[model samples]
Target: MRYLTDRKRAEGLGASKAGTEHHWYMNVSGVGLTLLIPFFVFILGTSLGAPYEEVVATLSQPFPAVIVGLTIAAGMLHFRRGAQMMIEDYWGGMTRKVMLWTVICLSYLVIAAGLYAIVRIAI
Candidate 1:
């Protein structure tokens, strides 16, 4: 029983389980964005040089629209998580909680809006 108690105390001072999970998520998102950025840049560049209808047509593709929507959602979620961590680390009092919640809510709203726009274009 004493050994278990001591182990728990030691674990408490170390990196949290949630912190590990967050790190994993952030790393995964970073890798995804690394691959996605080039594709997005190429697509945007081509679309910009094209005419207006061409732009619409390009975005109207189901696959590209879905990819864009997923990228937006993932990026927003990653940002929210990161910002929440920063707030928790640097801020104190009620302001930290408020800012964290605000960031979460705004992230969800942005993701929803992006999905709506993607669906509208795809369909």
Candidate 2:
């Protein structure tokens, strides 16, 4: 028979296995968003309130297009993770699963739509 302390026995069973991973992901994405948002805002501000042709021309430039794409992708992924965490915390059972999947799909859809718009504009 093996004798184990209670703490040892419970070491890995008391929490979600991916909690640390989730937390790290959220922190990293938060930092990335912090850095990217400023540039994104600047790019957006420059394009905002302009005529259609001017907006398209500004976004068509490689730098602005790439920045917008990155911002969209990162922002959506970050939003997905954060929303999942919130849903998991406040929900349970099948409802939790449904909400999680719905949020995931919605985030992806938004990302795809945003990127597609950017591509069309850039091209």
lDDT of 1 at 53: 84
- Residue-by-residue lDDT tens digits, candidate 2, 8-111: 56555536866656766889988998998999999999889999999999999998898899999999999999899899889999999999989999999999
> Residue 33 in model 1: shift from native, Å?
1.8
Residue by residue across 1-123, what tens digits does model 1's lDDT show? 365764445443545546556776899998997777777777667878798788879989876776677788888988998888889899989999899889999999999998898788667
Superposed Cα deviation of residue 99, candidate 1 (Å): 0.6
TM-scores for all predictions: 0.78, 0.84
Model 1: residue 96 alpha-carbon error in angstroms: 0.6
lDDT of each: 0.80, 0.89
